[model samples]
Target chain A: MNIDMIRASAARAEGHVRRTPLLNSHFLDEIAGRRVWIKPECLQHTGSFKFRGAWSALSSLNPEARAKGVIAYSSGNHAQGVALASKMHGAPAVIIMPKDSPRLKIANTRAYGAEVVLYDRAGESREEIGAKLAEERGLTLIKPYDEPQVIAGQGTTGLEIAQQAAEAGIENADVIVCCGGGGLTSGIALALEAEAPSFRVRPAEPEGFDDAARSLAQGKIVGNARPLGSICDAIVTPQPGDLTYPIMQRLAGPGLVVSDDEALQAMAQAFNRLKLVAEPGGAVALAAALFRGDEIEGDDVIVTISGGNVDAEMFERALQTRG
Target chain B: MNIDMIRASAARAEGHVRRTPLLNSHFLDEIAGRRVWIKPECLQHTGSFKFRGAWSALSSLNPEARAKGVIAYSSGNHAQGVALASKMHGAPAVIIMPKDSPRLKIANTRAYGAEVVLYDRAGESREEIGAKLAEERGLTLIKPYDEPQVIAGQGTTGLEIAQQAAEAGIENADVIVCCGGGGLTSGIALALEAEAPSFRVRPAEPEGFDDAARSLAQGKIVGNARPLGSICDAIVTPQPGDLTYPIMQRLAGPGLVVSDDEALQAMAQAFNRLKLVAEPGGAVALAAALFRGDEIEGDDVIVTISGGNVDAEMFERALQTRG
Candidate 1:
């Protein structure tokens, strides 16, 4: 919510989190016609920046509350983040996932020592199931992005970006972020506003599932008509969060959109040039940075590969894009 | 070389070289049956630790010598490393590579601003061509390994490992390294012997191309009868270097070898669990750690993924090994 709170979260999360490096390649620069810097959160603890927020929220809980347990509903990166964070904290977590979720994700979440409860996506309401389960098990429900602590946790990434940019001799540039419900985008926008005001944050979304882009354009929350069809399944929220939209509206630049193919091509580029694996959703910001360069200004541009949890088949397809 | 020389190289290469992070995965630990820490130089600039040595050798040169540029003979990682480093230092580089080398490697080396000269592996001697070119162009020949400054540069990796292990609370462990002409392995051995005495360096090689292992067993340098057949071409050298053999004989532990299949499997595991791209040769140390656990001791082990320059087809083959 604020710089102080984000700094506090950073303090709480220090030593527990990996300070991932800021990666760059001249090959990527050629594509964008400018110097391109990548903050590869794909190399983070849970292969995503979500772990920062997860650890922040879980660690801030009272000793007794943490001992009781926590619960959340996510089928992908957030599920794995909360699972690993809770396990590391010596606490239990119950993740409510749709039964139709990828088996690899469900298996990965469980492998991290969390209890996964699957419900039918068409027939069951995750909220009702989550609320009942939380009540029955005395578990705290950790919202994926809406809560203040979670946003502050995600904001810690922005603090790192500010410092890393300074280290890279970058005074001003647009910081592109992959956006789902505006949690990461808004958090980074707030942190950079306080710490590196010359730097601007821009939300990047996959086309056809670009709720964040539409919302920012209209100066209000707008819902996507079809969110389930995008290959960037990791970031397909129906609408921007009420809490995060205002922060993004006030601090962020115009949102950028790239097609799923662009995301795949970006994934291939990350793999070939930077030697980093990036899931399609995680690669959307990089895709925008490379393919939507006209909309992004400055001699330098920084973007985040927010996650790298794609399945093998999807990754193979990405590699084929380059071929 | 001594620790002081390595220290000087580290200082010279400080801002230019990326201090790649030490990454870990609990899943890798479970498979290895012990704690496994990964020093992923695959994330280094140029996607390999060769850049460290390249930068060190180039920067250590006198202004006049460096201005005349440099030459090296390598068809893969080392060629790219020297090219990028020379380019960055405002110096030209001439790389002599085999005509049969992968087109991707040849193209990448040239793209880094180096002039590539192709010679037939079966018909022409690269060393003779290299010597003629260096003498004619006034170019300093930077050997891929077996050179004092180059070894000192590679030794910087060991210095980082010692510090990172100390931070991770590891007092004693086997530090596994992929071995070629023993530049990296011997350099790390000499370094750990001085800095972290409890840490033992072990050379890892693909089976049948185990010259380092056979040499260490016989207490002398031994050449591989056939070195051109292995998929792990990155770390396949005919014999350990004269300069590096003595250092390894004095400070390194027994060498370990893994099958090419195992190396591919390790590469897949790196992709799945650590979100890292590990070419066949780079994955050998990790393969030995995970699949040859009986040859190692103690509760902890460290391994390096030395480089990641595999072409798309090779990486796909690695992915298939897991399936």
Candidate 2:
């Protein structure tokens, strides 16, 4: 899709979602040896960027389809996003979530007035469960990343970055985004490619789950070999989506990965300097920005802190982590 | 002194300090039973609003004083603000800090290239030390809250709030401010009185350290009966400043106070829903907003999350606090 579609999606999502703040820090800048601007999605509705695409998808649905409701599968962020968006639209949503997802995430999702169906991650396929739920309930299945509307909705972040960067007098920036299934990364890449060609989007993932990095390097879609346990649960999708992969493949630069420890350190630094509560998974881009500064070739960099739905225990541990 | 001065300060301080975003939360709105717009000063430079007034004070100084340098005494935030601002303006800064201040705060102030002299809180008066140093060094004393330029600098935040609230279509609001010595509160009150008179400013303080609240009620400055061993270290000033007390006395509504436990709860809630790391003092306004919803008379409310410079252990404890 073109920038026009993304702009239209931003217009549609306007007034429904928060225009989250863009923050700058001289301390972070000193560490990166460049001007570091941060877009904290932790402040977004449901504490993540998922709500952007969720609002886009649900709002795009026809009145009949909206009344019938929608179905989604997520570990946490996406579930809450979809639930809150659906509720705001007076529609019902059923979310198929992994049984092992963090309790805080599950509670937040339920608190948003959605029916949550917990399933075994190893035994049940979320896509299949979502499809079944949609068929059984006469609801539309809203794929988290593969849909155009969702991608367009996520592109609104790119539009905001471009607009905010321009306001800050920045013409060139290396944008680092936390990647799960390439939805946020690809959408941002497309928007930047259209609006700010001088700016580049770089995706960062956890060490054992760098599917996006592998896929970008090999010129094809790639999948993680196994679901290695990690603290960064938010961006551990097995593979990128079909629609999101191509845009990311075309527009994104070399990808980056950080250890879980590095992510924890990033979270702590974010709390100390930026005063934003970022979950370990949400801090991947910050980890990359802090550790992989040699790879950045721009005078300015934008790091996306994509989520903050971390449990209290985990957040406390993150706060105690030292770089 | 007025909106014009506040506007000029906003303009003067525009490029020096960040125009921190004003955030709106439906979740917070639900809790308050009104439109809750949050102006989180926790995101400002030096992780607090002190930087604003510091910059205004140092920048407005005469060439002779600016060249000679400046001196100040503060627990933490104001020290960092003055040090950074003085460094930026090519002036030397001597900061007198309490011996037992947070190690993180001491390290941060020194990181900005200031001479840090720690004095025993129980033995020495910071003001006397600061005055003595200013004489020996021929340095200007930048009082934290008692000066006009500093107050004007703090007023920049008020101008931003008024401008941002207007953009959000909020005409009248009960603006809750975390009160220390009334610098920020009085500055905001002055600005709001001139630019957004329908909107009222209310000062919120931690229990046992509610000197501002007591002084406002008595129509005269009143110090705490005893040294309050409070968790809200940032706002534990002896009493309101002579310059700040009058403005707050005339403009602010009846003040509110929250217990230390309530402050911690507010910090936890801010972390979970607002993705902000607020110190105990910084959170008093939010604590009032969350627990004292009955006192708010307007349809819209704005609460300022003032600072986020808490120690890691304290933040960890706050996260574990369930309310």
Candidate 3:
């Protein structure tokens, strides 16, 4: 991938995406024997880093394309991101979400003025409905991943982290990103590889959904027969994306896995000590770093916290389980 | 009274106190019919703005005084603040907390390396025990409020807000702060009154604990005979401090009250929209602006979020009630 092209894409989406603070964690520093910094995409507009990619893809469109509108297929962060970004650009958005998706996410997406089309994931594929709707309505289909512009947009987070970490006198650190389709991890890894070569990019995923980790080990893309039974519902993809797989293969430093219990404990730690309401998926990288200790090195480590849109009831249940 | 003196105290405590962000709120702007910003002291080291005052007090001490240690009397934020501040300053801290205080607070204070000194608030005065201990152990008693250095320290938050608002191109805005003993409100008012004369400072207290508002109106400090039944446990003080009352009388713009339900609703709103885990006390000023919309008249408004040390169960319940 061309670094300058990625940087240009990042510049285009700069104002649209929040320059979220890279927060320092005193508690994580003590436990991990490393200086830990969190890139809080959880604080981003629409509560996720998916906004970066969504805005990048939508904004790259010409006037005619934008006028035709955009369509996305996801029940999670990407849906909200695309909806909000399209709304910001005055372009209509149609999000095909699973009917069983969390009410909070659905409400949030619709609140951003996106036309939500609920479909049963068990009965029908969201892709089929989303593609059909896009074709029928003359709308642009914005893929959640597997797009160059989207990858370039996600790269901006890494760019910001590298800049901020350098300013903080953190010369080299492990940048841990939670992986599903590998958009976030691949983008971040490519950016870090080009800008801060000293910084290692580690992809962290839940145990059951370890496709990225397994793929990295096998030097090829891998697929899982069953989805992850982890609380990190956002990164439960069974396979990595075609575009992101090769990038991850080249740029990823290491891949790590953490259990559901570890992720829950890490989420609670973030809530109590850091005062950050990170979702289970968002807490996975930090969870892996803290739980799978020897996998990471150096005194300084940066974890890309992907989102903060966990269901309130689910958060309560997680807290109760902690007790 | 001396602005330079306050600035010096702030500078002395800069490293110890968190330079909390003045966050922009899109949700608040849409709901309140104005651009809203939040100074999130809730994410401070001890989960409250009290940490700034306590840290300032401890840091300003002479070498001899530092060696002797510090003591404080409180069942909430103040206790935790003093404990954490003293620990940061490498001084022994003894917190005289009410015996009936929540187990969580006791655990927090102890976690910060303070010696927990429980006193029977029903039978004996906590102040008496604190004073006795201070005298016997040669430890300086750090009052929660009513201290010049502490007030000056709290004033730093206002200073930063003024600077941040200016940077954000907000020339004039109404700054609302939650009032307890008027420490935070008075300090913030004084800072804004001096540095940003165009800006106005308002005191927002929970409905039942409207002593600050009552006293402001009557031009004399008045105590609430009955305990407030608000969920904002941190700001349920019965009276304003002597030092804070006079400062507030001279500098405070206005006084307002918000209901417990409003505070809880605001907390839920902050969690969902801003991804902030603010406790009830922290959300009061925002709640005042949100619930009592008719009284406010400004294009820009800044609300001070005081703390985020809410119990997980309490937070869960609040979410369920207002989610």
Error of 3 at A248 (Å): 2.1
Candidate 1's displacement at residue B84, Å, is: 0.7
Each prediction's DockQ against the real complex? 0.82, 0.79, 0.63
Of the true interface contacts, each candidate retains a share of: 0.69, 0.90, 0.71
Q: Give a tens-digit lDDT track for model 2, residues B1-323.
A: 66676777777786778888888666777777888888999998889999999999988888889999999888678999999998888999989888998787788898887899999989888878877888898999889899988999998889889889988899879999999889999999999888899998999998888898899988899999767688998888899999999999899968989999999998998988888999999999988988898888878989898899888889988887886
Best by DockQ: 1
B18-82 per-residue lDDT for model 1 (tens digits): 99899899889989999999999988989999999999999999999999989999988889999
RMSD per candidate (Å) reads 1.2, 2.2, 2.8
Instruction: Note the residue pairs that clash in candidate 2.
Output: none
lDDT of 3 at A230: 67
The best candidate in terms of TM-score: 1
lDDT of 1 at A147: 86
TM-score of chain B of 3: 0.97
lDDT for each residue of candidate 2 in A1-323, tens digit (9 for 90 to 100): 77888888999988777787689777888887889999999988888999999999999999999999998888678888999999999999898888997787787788898998999988988778777878887998888788998889888999999888998998878999999988899889989988888998999999989999999999999899876577998888889889998999889969999999999999998998899999999999998988899888889889899999887888888877777
Query: Which regions of candidate 3 are displaced past 4 Å?
Result: A13-16, A24-26, A30-34, A62-64, A99-104, A118-138, A167-172, A227-230, B13-16, B24-26, B122-125, B227-229
**C-alpha positional error of residue B314 in candidate 1 after TM-score superposition, expressed in Å:** 1.1
**TM-score to native of every candidate shown:** 0.98, 0.95, 0.92
Give lDDT tens digits, candidate 1, residues A169-276. Answer: 998699999999888998899899998999879999998988888888888888999758899988888899989999999999699999989999999998888889
Model 3 lDDT per residue over A15-123, tens place: 5577877776556777788888888888888888999999989889999999989998887899988998898999999988889877877877898889999998789
